[model samples]
Structure formats: C-alpha cells, structure tokens
Target chain A: MNKELVEKIKNDPNYQELVSKRSSFSIKLTIAMLAVYFAFILTIAFKPALLGTPLSADSVTTVGIPVGIAVIIFAFILTGIYTKRANTEFDDLTNKIKNAIKEH
Target chain B: MNRTFLFLVLGSIAVFASGAIEGEVQKQALNMSAIVMFLIFVSATLGITYWAAKRTKSAKDFYTAGGGITGFQNGMAIAGDYMSAASFLGISGLVYMKGYDGLIYSIGFLVGWPIILFMIAEPLRNLGKYTFADVASYRLRQTPIRTLAASGSIATVVLYLIAQMVGAGKLIELLFGLNYEVAVILVGVLMILYVTFGGMLATTWVQIIKAFLLLSGASFMAIAVMAHYDFSFGALFTHATELKGIAIMSPGGLVSDPISAISLAIALMFGTAGLPHILMRFFTVSDAKEARKSVFYATGFIGYFYILTFIIGFGAIVMVFKNPAYLDVVKNAVDGTSPILGGSNMAAIHLSHAVGGDFFLGFISAVAFATILAVVSGLTLAGASAISHDLYASVIKRGNVDSMKEMRVSKIATVILGIVAIIMGIMFEKQNIAFVVGLAFAIAASANFPILVLSMYWRKLTTRGAVVGGSLGLATAILLVILSPTVWVKILGYKTAIFPYEHPALFSVAVAFIAIWFFSITDKSENAKEEQEAFEAQYIRSQTGIGAEGASH
Candidate 1:
C-alpha cells in the first residue's frame, strides 16, 4: 500500500477508536478467560477435595462437573460477546475509517 | 474420468480388505459392519476429492479455497480440525479411567478458542495469506522469519502427525479389527489423496463432514447413556460413583503439583493459537468479520463436543466398566481387576457397542477413522504450506516462484509428509506416544506463538530478536521435553528427570519474551530502525484491513 493511505488511516480518529476499543475489550476478555481457567486449574492443583464435595449431603454428583462445564460455557459466551461487539460496533468504526480514506 | 477415480479407490480398498482379512484371521472375527461403514465414508470423501480437484485451479484455491468459505462453514471446519480422534477418544478414555480429571483437559482445550478469537483471529485474517508465516514475516526479514516460522510449523505438524498416526493405527486395530500397518497406510493414503488433489476446499469439506458425523454420533451415545438414567446426570453419576467410587468425581494424578498444573495450562491455552492448521483456517474466510464469526461458532461447537465426550466417558464408566461381556476375562483374572477389551482408550468405542449395539459401533468406528483422516489431511496441508509457501516460494525463491510451481511443490510436500507419517506411525507403534502431542503443543506455544504475537504486537521486534528468541524457545521446549520425566524416565530409562516438570512452556515462553525484548532493544543496526519504522504500516493493515491480501472484492 502507498504511504499516504497508511498514514491517513493511521491518523484517522475512527481507526484510533476502533483499535483502542477493540484492544482493551479483547485484553479484558482475555484476562477474564485466563482468570477463570487458572482459577480452576489452581483449584485442581491445591484443593482436589473441594471439587470432590457433592452438591448436597445426599447428592452423588460432585461440584467439579458443573464447574468444568461452566468454564467451557463461559469461554463460548465470551467469544459470543466479542464477536457481537466486533461485528457491530468495532466494524462500524472500521467502515468509517475506510470511507474517510476513500473520499480523500 | 470420474469412473477411473472410482475404480482406483475401489481397487485400493480391495487390496486393504484382503490384507485386513488375512491379518484378522489370527486375531479375532472380522468386523464386517465396521469395514462396510468405513468403506462408505472413504468412497464418499474420495468423491468429494474428485469434485474439489476440478475447482482447484489456482494456488489461492489450493490453499484457501479462493477465500470463498462462509463464516459458519469455516466454523464447522475449524471445529472438525480441532476435534481430532485424540480429543474424542483420548479425553473420553481419560474420563472413563480417571473421571473428573478428564474435564481438566477439556477445559484447557476449550479455553484456547476464546483467547484466539479475542486476540489473534482478526489480526491474522487482516494480515496473512495462505500460511501463518505470512503474518510473522510481514515486516520482518522474510527469509529468516519465514525459515523460523516454517521450522516451528513443521515441527508441530510432524509431532502431532506421529501422535495421530499411532493412535489411528491402534484405534483402528481395536475398532475395525484391521491390521495396524494397514490402518496406518489407509490413513496416509486417504490423507494424501484429499490434500494432493482436493486441496483446502476438499480438506475443509472433509473436516466439516467428519465433524458433523462425530458430533451426531457422540450426541447419540451421550443421549443413549442419559436415556438409561432418565436423562438425569445425577443418576448417571450416582451409578458411576457406586461402581468406580467417589474418587472418580474429583481430580486424580494428572496434575498433582501447582507448577505442573500452571505449566500445562499455559501450553494448552497459547499452543492452540500457534497451531498452523488452526491458524490457517482464518484465511479461508473472506474477511475479518467472518474470521471472528468463525471462532465464535468454532468455540461453541468445540465446547459442546467436549461436553458430549465427558458424558460419553462417564457413561462408559457406568456401562462398560463393570460389564463382563466387554471385559477380557483372562486378563481380568490375571490382574484381579476387570479391564476392558482394548484398554481404557477404547472406552468410548466399547460404550458405543454397549449402548448402541454393533451397527452403532460400526458407525462410531467409521467416524473415528474419518476423524483421523481429516486431522492428518489438515496437518499435511499446513506442513506442505510451510515447506512450499514459506520455504520454497518466499525464502528459497525470494517470492519469485510462479503460482503453478509453488502449487506443485506443495503437492510434492504433501506426498512426502504422508509417506513419512505412515512410516513413523509404523515405527512408533510400540513406543509410548502420549508425550508427542504435548511436546507439539509446547513447541507451538513457545516458538510459533511468541514470534507471531510479538511481530504483530511489539513495535520494536526486529528480525534478529525474532530469530534468536524463537530459535531459543524452540530449542528449549524440545530440550526440556527430552530431559523431562515423560521422556527421560519413561522412554530413556533414566531414574530421575533433569527437568522436574513434564511441561516446558512456562520457562520457554518466558525465555522467548525476555530474549526478544533484550535483543531488539540492544540492536543498533540501520535495518532494525527500518523494521521498527515499518511496523506502523503493518499495524495499520492488521488493525484496519487496509492493503490486506485477498480482502479486496
């Protein structure tokens, strides 16, 4: 690509907005995921019996089953949130940036 | 022409059938249903390959199906690539054997997808063409960076191939009652045909179909298991706890220590983003929007699939573990404990028969075989792209090679990779290969992931830093694996491991980041300055998709 176009896009406020919003959003989501996963892993490492405890006194199922499945579901949910925002909000900013460059 | 291809496929199947019959007479009764189902799957895939071959006229078409795949389709294909035979059988088998411990792996694997979607997927789609090396080498020195990326890709691919191949051979032996060598050869041959002729389009279709079949089959098994318990997981777990004890509901010996747990978690998480086959799936979409969408769908499908496998595992524990019919009585008598017919890895396979009978067993067996073919084909294509697109086209020829020549080179590489996979599969048949996949993940997380991430994110990453840091990370990961317990104690017959932990990603990734930071800041070269300056354009393209290859309609 030409230098002028890149410079123009780089300096565009929409591009800046898109980059900052997306990066922060992604970083937050990433931190959330790592936190959840590492929490689960650490729990497994240090306190195995905690997860082994049944839901109720008479219950056969342990707490780990739902917890593990929750982590998986949380991951999917996080992806959904990101995709929804990226396709709608961030993508709008990107299109504005592109249009600005084209008109120039 | 179609008739000729059909004849060729049938002729090969005939030869394999004869060999299987001769080999199985000494083992046990032949599984005619499995063989028939497998033949049908193989014939259908071969027909898809024949069709894809017609449309694959350009290098772009060969690599990314001309970027024509929709978001949802690419999502299914990505899920197909991720849900290999290893994850399906291996994780379920772990659950069957160790109970709640298996969920650790499932969670680790699923967690990578969200991270990939959040960070890597869009930038990757906005930047690269064909292989991931395109992104890594975007502003850096092409030759060294491409060389490094290709080495990492090939190493990851070959290691993963060996694991998949060995597992395929053994699983087919138990499931199809076929000879191990025949099974390996069958996988290698089918992979070669799919990739060499059909390219990305065929590979994607094959993966999607296999993913669909596997999901449906596993769903059926899970539903069947739940049906027996009135659709209550509590009832199922109650039975499992009664049979296997309550210890099965908690963590076992898989990750006993804190460091090992964290190290393994890191490897499983980032190693996925570094995987070439998975990363390559991004470019198959038309734009970054589709790329993002694909990950969303892939994560959901994969997470749902893992949940099914967990159910299947617990189901197997309750159904197949105590059943005398599925147990090998002689072995059980000697061991004083009932063991399933083909070991714990066959837990899901045995559960298929217990729950769904011979016909369903035949279907699951075929699906498992198809899963292997799909995974290996994806691996082979990635490896070939590394060799041809990165090494031959860009590095060796200085990006001057014609598309046709590059395509031919990739085809040749695919054939070579297939042969090597088959041979290695046979060679490693008796050896313990459980560590191979882990090592692949380690290398990917350490080497490929660091450089790719740094090149895109770190403004000061020079060619020197990337080459030095990536090579050190790669070397360290491999070296640590060699000195770790899995290899040193188990394979090499050493009494004690030099590396205390089995996983090396934590240390190796730290080394890579530190080394890259150290080298890039210390460098005083004019070229380094220019590379730093070039990052703005690369970043713009990465963020905004301006000047991105194949983005223009």
Candidate 2:
C-alpha cells in the first residue's frame, strides 16, 4: 500500500460516506439473499404437480430449478441495490465534507 | 477419413484465410437495408464518439461521462449493456428449448435490478468517481487496494468480453453461414472501433438506443403471443401443457433434482449482483436518485421482457412442435457438436420472418448484430479501463496524474485490450461460447463483491485486510474457475477435473467474506480512531443524498 492512499483514506469524506453506507446493504442484503435462498428451498420442497407441463422453454424439469435459479439471482440484485445506494450516498456526503475542508 | 472431419478442416482453413484478409468482401447480408442500417449505426456511433471526444477535455469526462448522466438514463444504459446477445438470444433460446428452466436465468437476472434499486444504487453512486477502484481506495492504501480492484475488474471485464465475443461469433454463424472465426473477428473489430473513437458518451448513447429497441422488439412479440392465444394466460398455459406433456407451469418443470436447484439459485443471485460489467453500471449515473430510478425502470422493463421471454420460449415449443426447425440437431445438424440454435433466437427470427419476410429477418438480425456489438464494446471498454485507468493510472501511478496524459494512456490501453480480445476471440472461436458468461459471473461473485461490500460497511477493514482479503478472494475465485471442469477438462481437453467444487461462487464468496472479517478484526490500527471519526461525518452527509425520506440527516 502506498503512503498517499493511506493519507487520502484518512482525509477522504467520500470514503467515510461509503463506509457508513454499509447499514443499508446490511438491511436488505440478508433478506434478499434469504428470499432467493428460501424460494429455492420451498420450490424444491414442494414440486407441486401441475397438469400437462405448460409449454416450457423445452424440457420438463422439476419446478425447483427455475425458481431456485430465480431466487439465487435475487441475491445479486439485492447486493447490487445495496452497493449502488451506499456508494452514492456515501460519496455525496464525503464530497460535501471535502468541500467544507477545502473552504477552511 | 470422415465427411465431418473433412468439413472441419475446410472450415478451419477458410477461417484462417479470412482472418488474414484485411479487405472486405461482398457479404450478401450487407445488402441495401443493411447498408442503411450500418450508416445509421456508424453515424450514431461516430457522432457520439466525436461528441465524447470533444467533451473528454478532462480525465473525468472520458471515464465517466463527466458524471452527468441521470440515474434513469444510466439504468437504461445498464439494461442495454446487461441485455446482451446472451440475454436476447440465449435466454430466449433457453426458454424456448428448456421451458421453465430458462426462466431461471431471466428472472434471476432481472430480479437483481430491484435489489440494485432498494439497496446499493444510491450509496454506490454517491461513493465513487469514475471507477469502483475509487470506492475501494477511498478508505484503503492505493498500491495493494487499487491493484486488487484493478485486477478483479480486469478479470471480470476480460471474461465478460470473451463471453460477448463468443456470442458474436455464434450469432454471426447462425444468421450468416460464415465460419465462426470470421464472425468473431468481424464483431471484434467493430467493437474496437466502437470504443476507440466514441469512449463513454458514445457507448452510453448506443446502449440507450439499443435498450429501447430490444425492449420494444420483445414487447411486439409479447403482444403477438397474447393475440395468438386470445390474450388469455389460462389458454396459453393449457396450450403449453398440451404441447409439453409434463407439468410445465406448475413447479415440477423447474429441475430434476431439488438440491441442484437450490445451489444453482445461490450461484445466480449472488453472481448477478457481483458481475463487473453490471456493477460498473452503478458508476455511470450522476446521482443516487437516478441510479435508483434506473434500477426501477430496468426492473419494470425487464419484468416485461422476462414474461415475454416465457411467452416466446413457450411459443417456440409450440412452433417447433408444429414445424420442427431442424428436427432436433441430431437429424438436422451436420454434426453433434453445435447446438440446435433453432430454439429461441430462431423462433423470434422465424416469427419476424413469418410475419414480415426478408425485410423483417434482416431487421431483427441487424438489431441482434448491433446488440452483440454494443455489448462487446462496453465490456471491452470496461476491461481496458480496468487495466489502463485502474491498474496503470491509479495503482501504477498511485492516483497521481495529469488529466490529458492519463486519458491518453487509457485510450492506448483500450486499443491494446481490444486487440487482445480480438486475438483471444479468433483463437477460441469454436468453444462453447455462452459458458464464457457463466465463468464471468463466477469471478464477479467471488472476487469483486466481497471487498466492495466489506470496505464500505466494516470500519475495521484496514488496508492490509482489504488488500489481503481482496487478493485471496480474487485468486481463489479465478483459480477455481480456471481449474473447473469447464475449462480444465472440456475446453483445455484435459483428462480430469482438478477441483472438487465445480461452482466457485459457493466457496469463494464465503472465503472472501471470512478473510475480510478476519483481517479487519485481528489487526487493530493506529489510524482507526481518525478513520472512524471521518467515516461517521461522511456518512451523515451521504444520508442527505438518499431520497427525501432518507434526507433526514
């Protein structure tokens, strides 16, 4: 690690803002990850019997796969939402502070 | 000895010859309509490039469109970039061929948008300038931290570019019977040009334009699906069941094994969130609010796209039943190697042809071609940025720079990276193409996301902790992927799979998280108190930028 980055890290308002932006990700990350996880589980647990397979993409696998896949996908979505929000809010605040410090 | 072998040798020679040839030929597909389309595309591209070139007076504008793009536009651009040839052709084909299984990819992918909206969009937007490296290095040392982020970004971008490049080749071969190498190089050059001249502004506009077309095209087809079935989903479902002979709609159509389903889902959700090209989308927006809006719009648009994909996929099942396109690759294909691409991409193409004819086929094909080009351009640019900007400028130069000089380096980097992609594309022309994307997702989930999340949230996440943890995660994820059965055995023609775990996401994600937490805790820092105070003050300010409700700071 370079000395300058450490110095910048110490002074960076945006970095601090990003660091605090963690609370938002923490709130939604667990549930979104879990929702996808649980959805996958429930889908597998109860592969409910439907009439003739609805015109599928092609093959007739268990209902668990697509739904499970969907759920797993949800995890990333949840995480992305968290990161994007955190970065923005954090940066704006940091920028403001930096501006203030510059004024002083 | 065999006809197949004879054809393969001939095909290889033809590919080699074309790759050597610098001049253009009278490609039949490049007819009058195509000429017009290319004019429009090229004009649009060059126009954006010139504009971007002019506006790129500083490094800031060159890398991030001057951070002026609205979140909604950025979101749309993300959608444009994210909805690649894979999403357009592959998912549709998957849904067309696999039925409910295909929906897994679609829903999983689109679902991540809403997650982006609610969770990470704004914070990420407000947190960084230009690149993700800026975000990570904000709190950490530049050398190791920038190196890790740059490497991770590079890995993601290259893997992603390869995937897009592969898709371009496959689509070209399918649409035009040119050999795969020709297809790859053709698209590769087009992509290089797209990025070389235009930069971010051009790329953004291309994406915005393409996104609207893709969604509208899907929308048109979706309407056709409803009209075909009298707009009754029940009728559509019933018809689908009759065609499938199994319960396609009611849960059982998901997977053969339930656990496989669970694991697969875990891979995709985490995977989507962490993707390099996708995560980079958050950086494009000017503010958090717009980022949020972009995600919401993308989710809504994509939700419709997913639903339409289902309809279209199912339509193929019915269409193929009535008219077997190639009668299942075995009876139709010259060999067993290539997939029967007659499923989703072909279905939509076929539907367009059926409804309109040569004009329509050419239009959709043009759109598909442009779709792949636009995506490959973005992926290549991101990769080049990771290398030039993140690695060279930020890490190598320690974020110290003259504006114009750094931007020039980035341009040179872009050219170099583009050439590399072209070489790789030509070399790996015939391998299973879409799998390139799966590998990309694996890298993203395992390498980038962990460090990004932990750095922002964990106060104890010291520079050493971030550097070590980030590298470990990146190395572990990439190494696992490199050794996985897909690459080691299948692609490399190796005898056996080296690693026990096929999917890196499951293990890599956990390892990265543990490493971050462990390193952050074990080392108590002298700078910790000052860092804490600064971080708290920054947080209060950031909270102000969160929507009005969140402005309660």
TM-score of chain A of each: 0.96, 0.50
lDDT of each: 0.86, 0.61
Candidate 2: residue B522 Cα off by (Å)? 1.4
In CAPRI terms, model 2 is classed as: incorrect
RMSD of 2: 8.1
**For model 2 chain B, the run of ten residues with the poorest summed lDDT:** B1-10
Candidate 1 iRMSD, 1 decimal:
0.9
Stretches > 4 Å off in candidate 1: B1-28, B551-553
Model 2 spans with C-alpha error above 4 angstroms: A1-33, A40-42, A45-104, B1-39, B177-179, B250-263, B324-345, B432-435, B488-501, B525-534, B545-553
> Fnat of each prediction?
0.90, 0.13
The top-ranked prediction according to TM-score is 1
- lDDT score of model 1? 0.86
